[model samples]
Target chain A: MKKEHVKIANREALIGVGLVIFNFVWWFAFAYGLGSKDPQEYTYVFGLPAWFFYSCVVGFIIMAVLVTIVVKKFFVAIPFDEEVEE
Target chain B: MNWESLIPLILFIIIIFCVGIWSGGYLKKSTSFAQDYFLGGRSLGGFVLAMTMTATYGSASSFIGGPGTAYNQGLGWVLLAMSQVATGYFVLMILGKKFAVVTRRYNALTMVDFLKQRYQSKWVVILSAVSIIIFLFSAMAAQWIGGARLIESLIGIEYTTALFIFAVSVLIYVTVGGFRAVALTDAIQGSVMFVGTLILLIAVIIAGGGIPNIIADLTAENPNLITPFGADGSLTPTYVSSFWILVGVGVVALPQIAIRAMSYKSSQSMHRAIIIGTIVVGVIMLNMHLIGVFARPILPGIEVGDRVMPLIALEVMPNWLAGIVLAAPMAAIMSTVDSLLLLVSSTIVKDVYLNYVKPTASDQRVKRLSITITAILGVIVFIMALNPPDLIIWLNLFAFGGLEAAFIWPIVLGLYWSKGNKYGALGSMVAGVGLYILSDSFFPQPFGLHSVVMPIVVSFFVYIAASLATQKKTV
Candidate 1:
């Protein structure tokens, strides 16, 4: 039982770390890749340029959705009163 | 001064006071004053937890200073600022249910309490408490200044008078009702921020003659303004990307934020908060920053960037409605200030004083000390705010970077890595804080990245190395 809990803890920790890395990469890629375009090569979308629209507006919505999905699906809901494995 | 606009603001203040008094009733009936005062007795529901966290995290910096910077930096700043969308998710998701369970097991009231119990070291607790006092005091002062500035611009009052009013209002609610009051008020304030930002953004867009006209006006003024490089093209790719660490992932180390991770009632609340908080933060940050950029076309040549939100609201909307909308920034500032005030006081009263100064002090004495410390801290921050900076965002960001560097590895690794001992915690903190301060002062934007990036990276290696070196000594 103890070993099983440890395995579960490790899995959760890995998921947490993985989520952090994925969120970081998502923002970095959107900011650097899409947000670094020159003004001369811009296309406007709903008054915002394509880069700003894609990287910030779309990126923000996508992130909110993605983060919500990850949290609800993978995160195990342990009762706070129970013994927490370190 | 527009007395009409002031009416809405006055009404908002009255509502906040009422909420404080209501929460004070709960405080009075609690069996444990310390826990109830500091942690709301760890009974925060899903929505309340989400709102309080979002409200506390979104401060005058996000509402006032952030939008102001966005106005100056153009759409690129908005893109950069959006990195904060995942702040709530990251904090709750990373810490999760284990933090809640462990903190309850330890009966830890403050983040320093956690550090003391986890590391079993006197120095670690002292350092954590000291860092919270030092960095959070600066952050609190920035919030005070931001609150005062918003009031000053809204009503055309003298800066000193506005500062005094702002300080007194926050001190009364925070000192009287404590964390329950802060959390309760934050729920209201967070809602105000959400609705207020959306209303103001739509008003700005409409006033500027739609989005197309606003973009054309910006492009006409400066073609670069419509691009991703900022108004003057100063927002480089590297600088923008590095902010993901400073404001994004690195936020897990912040005590004010991390403490919330453990305050919820259950894993269900945490999960609920992750979804609600992320959506609220995303909406508020995106709309608030966009309003900053959109304000440019309607109100050109505004000198102080911090005044953009209030100034734009007044220009585009009716006086009373503008006042109502401006409450968003006020709410953001007050929620942040109240939490910081309580956190610092708890550090003094519960962590430092109770632990070292007077371990056997009576509960009444601790309560009085907590209230008195919060009031004194408020006054000190008020005095500090009298001599304000041109932009309070940098001061706020400085505090964020310092706290993140000091506590990130210590708290995160200490929880997960069994081998992480007191020595590793101390070393990580010292290296994180020391290198962060040194780089911020002399080597800002090192290699075109924000100064915070280097310290966080260096501290990670130090933590691993120091832990490995000290493992045998511990056993």
Candidate 2:
């Protein structure tokens, strides 16, 4: 039982790190990859530059949704009262 | 000063004081005064837990200094600041269940308590306490200055008088109510920040004649303002990416935020907090920084970046509505100040005084000391804030980097890696902090990365080497 609990926590932490990396890759790519273009050549989405529109605005919604799903599906509710034996 | 705007702020302060006093009543009837006062008896629920973490993490830096910097740097800064969206998620998720179980098993009140029990080293406790006090002092001073600056601009009061008022208000409630007061006030403050950010964003966009017009003005002035490289192209891709470590992953080591991980009522609250916190932080950070970038077209050439948030709000909205919206930054500053004040006080009283000074001290004595220490720390920070930096964000970020450097590896590796011993923890902190200061002062942005990255990287190896070298000694 104890080993299983530790495994669950480790798995969740990995998922958390995975989400962070995924968010960073998305943010960096859109921010720099597309944003590296000249200003005169930029496209607008809702008044924000295309890069920002994708990186920050769209990225935020994606992260919020992804995080909600991850928490609901991947995270297991663990008891806080009992002291885990070392 | 417009009296209409000041009324809402005054009303907000009054409500916070009432909450503080109400929570103080609980302090006296608690079975475990230390636990109740320091950790809020670990009874935090979902919404309160999420809000408190959000409020505490979203300090004057995020509300005032962040917008100020974003206003200067333009949209690039906003992209960099968005790294914070995952802050609450990382803290709650990585440290969520295991941290709560272990700390509860150890009956640890502060982060230092956990370090002390886990490492069983006097140096570890002393170092943790010292680093928290040193780093959090600057962090607290940043909040105090932000508070005073907001009050000074809003009410048109003298800086000294504003500082005095801000300091007194925070000390009164924090000393009276403890963590419960801080957490409760944080819930209110966090909500204020969310609504304020949304309202101000829409107002700024409308005032700037919408997004297309604003982007046009920005391009006319400097095309780089709308780019990812900042107004002057100083925000390099390398530097921006490193911030993912500074504000993103490394935040788990912040004592003020980490303590919240152990104080929640159950796993359900942690899970709930993770979702709620991620969404709130995303919305608030994205909107607040966007407001900073958007305000550029409306209010151009503001010399002080911190003044942008208040100046733009007053310019775009009616005086009454401006006052109410401005309370959001005020709430952010106060919530952060109260939490830091409590954290430093706990480090001094619970970690240092109780552990080393007098282990046999009575509950009443500890309680009195905690209150007294909290007030004293507030006064000291007020003194530090009097000579404010032109941009308080650097000071706040400097504190963040230093604390993360010192605590990140020890806290994370200690939990996961069984081979992590006292030598490793101690070695990591010393190397991390030492290298961080050296890099920050002499060789900032070495290799085009933030100074924090090197120290954190170097210390991770140092932790493993030191731990492996000393394995036989422990056995």
What's the TM-score of each model vs. the native?
0.95, 0.97
For candidate 1, give the docking quality class from DockQ.
medium
Tens digit per residue, CA lDDT, model 2, B99-187: 99889889999999999998999999999998898778778887788789889988999999999999988999999999999999999
- For candidate 2, the per-residue lDDT at B358 reads 100
Candidate with best TM-score: 2
| Candidate 1 local Cα displacement, residue B177, angstroms | 0.9
lDDT of 2 by residue, A1-86 (tens): 37778888889999989999899999988988889989989988987899999999999899999999998888898776675456
> Could you tell me how far off, in angstroms, the CA of residue B356 lies in candidate 2 after the best superposition?
0.7
Off by over 4 Å in 2: A83-86, B60-64, B386-397
Q: What DockQ, on C-alphas, does every prediction get? A: 0.57, 0.81
